[model samples]
Target: MKPKLLTLSLVSAITPITLLAEDVTTLPTITVEGERLPEPGISREKPEDMVGTPADAGDFLRDIPGVSGTRMGGHGIDPIIRGQSQTQLNILLDGAYVHGGCPNRMDPPTAYSPVETYDSVTVIKGSQTVIYGGGGSGGTVLFERKTPRLTEDKFIRGQVGGGYTTNSGTKELFGDVTAGSTQGFARGIIEYRDADNYEDGSGNETRSAHTSQTGNLILGYTPNDKTRLELGLEANRTEDVLYSGAGMDSPQADNDTIRLKYENQWGTKADVYYSDVEHVMDNYSLRSLTAPMKMRVPSKSKTQGGRISHNLLMDNEMEWTMGFDYQHNNRDANRFAGPPNMPTPTMLQSIMWPDVDLTQIGMFGEMQMPVRDIHILKMGLRYDRVTSEANRAGQAAMGGVTPNRLYQQYYGKNADVVDENNIGGFI
Candidate 1:
């Protein structure tokens, strides 16, 4: 057995800690640019900042420069960009497409979107991007609502908002609640708006008044950091919508929508959505019988669409995307017109739209690369096949309807119930 003992010496070294403090008289100046003019025709705005700012969605779009709205009454104004509207412009709500049931431009796509509920509004000036959808000859408008990401262990959040306007005697109330944890989340929203007939500056009241109510529920599942799936449902109701241009007022409109979305870490995403709208308009609902004639129109629209896209990255400076999208919209409208204060006459019943159906399928590819330190290059290509068809024959006041006569008399000689196939591409 051997035992060893060692001696230890302790040495101390002086170390100086320099506490440097210099008297500073001036601070570095930082110049910040807050607002700049948008692109020639494109514009973007945060809906929260513009709350209680406009009368309706149409008015909201008009706030952007170069955008104008055709104001026919107190609400549901049609937005026109540069000089085009209707089919010329493409509009989307939360990436879903919706077409109005009105044929006389009384209810455009914008009519269904309660701008207050959206998070942001983006206006694409022209047919520059074929990524969203086709038929953007005039422009594209996107209203998006971003879902909240739950990153905390536990959280409960809510928002409540309300506003009023005097000109149209309008009132609005909105509320939202979201409670969730890190793995999953659930959110719900409710909104209501009502307005009375608005008078002009001259105190002449117009037949423009409306009431709307909407509710939404969304459920999100995030199993991991790289995968997510969401399901959403929404319902909307609008009553007593008076139109100055049309001969009737919308007495009732009920709309419902369902959406499902999935995304993965591989940069692949898919979205599917479906919407149905039922609308009824009649003169007697909000107006007295005029011109010794009473009219009523009932319409319906159904829409469904989906898209699948994948993003690819090559090296660090180049990127590419390819996707395919399909959308189908069908509209049916009929009118009943008769003498006032008398039994409804058979002669006045007529087919207005006669089941018009529009289908569009498109494929698109795009690439982006940095050309230089000061500039970037981007290019996209899209091909779309569109089909528009409708029943041509209708019941006339006098009698005997013919498809050839209806076609040649209104549009052209070869105008039948089915239109020619249309195929086009854009870059």
Candidate 2:
């Protein structure tokens, strides 16, 4: 026996967070399993909570009980959020409705919202929050940056990391540097994302790979413990080649987005926010070089909006949130023949997406009641006012065909001051 007492070796391989979670933590107000705080009120946590990217954010929300959204390219999943699309759910960025020019759903709202930038995402399942404006007509999603904690003294901290995707064989880099003092703080970040098209596990191309870039600047000042002020400017840009299953020729496309926001909270975290967003799509193009002839489908669209919200932390524990917003859309479209349809040399009409403009304002409110730490009762109300305009030649102004006036037509049948509501519970 080789000195039985001398032959002793101990090796430990434990992650920092794992070790932390194992010790000295009995009750955590907000568990950071990496942004996965499940339905806390009677709603246990789930795996979908941790999917971080914008492309995957909706998947998490959809998997939540009583929630679902449409899927495309295996990414940019747009949630139905209780049977609602587009304008129904108020998918907000810094509290403003962000609208992209792509009518084909190629680049959904989240496309302009690079998910990695936000610290936390809150989904108001139904008409739970009053401030989401037009998009929230369906529901409201709040993607917010983490506010710096009011520590006793000055401190400096930061995190940096990168990842690689097997599907697209793409590499991405993103992170942040945070420096602070007792009075205030500032942080900034730049992210570059690019990847060739990804092939599904079956080795079949998904036609969903694109290059994306985002940059954000954040500033904050907490003069005192009860008051916090925050300002942030963010941008998301992406480009890709669209390959339609029906069309042979591929069309290259691009989108540009900008968002600015200011937020402040009163006593006990009563939230107030004001934000503005601008989005521009260079052009939505598709190939016309088909069996019939050579052609080109080309168009351009732009949208801009502003929004505001105020929250009241009532004694009843009804986390009440309310707000308003407006949006404008401008479009121009045409079909140019260089390939197919050349025989008659068909002229792409502007009718498909006519020159349509709309402005919407709405008021909404929501409150939740916690029942025995096992049941959650939530209710909401919303009132919307819309103003629509179709230029006599709004179509001609943008070289479009006859006016489509989609929402306007719907409102024509339904009228302004639309009333919308939502109710649900999870235990």
Highest-scoring model, lDDT: 1
* TM-scores for every candidate against the unseen true structure: 0.86, 0.67
lDDT of 1 by residue, 172-223 (tens): 9989888888778898988899998888889988878889898989898887
**What are the per-model C-alpha RMSD values against the true structure?**
11.6, 13.0
Best by TM-score: 1
Residue 413 local lDDT, model 1: 69
Clash counts per candidate, in order, are 0, 24
Candidate 1 ranges with C-alpha deviation above 4 Å = 1-41, 224-226, 342-348, 391-398, 402-404, 414-427
Evaluated at residue 329, the lDDT of candidate 2 is 57
Check candidate 1 and list the clashing pairs. Answer: none
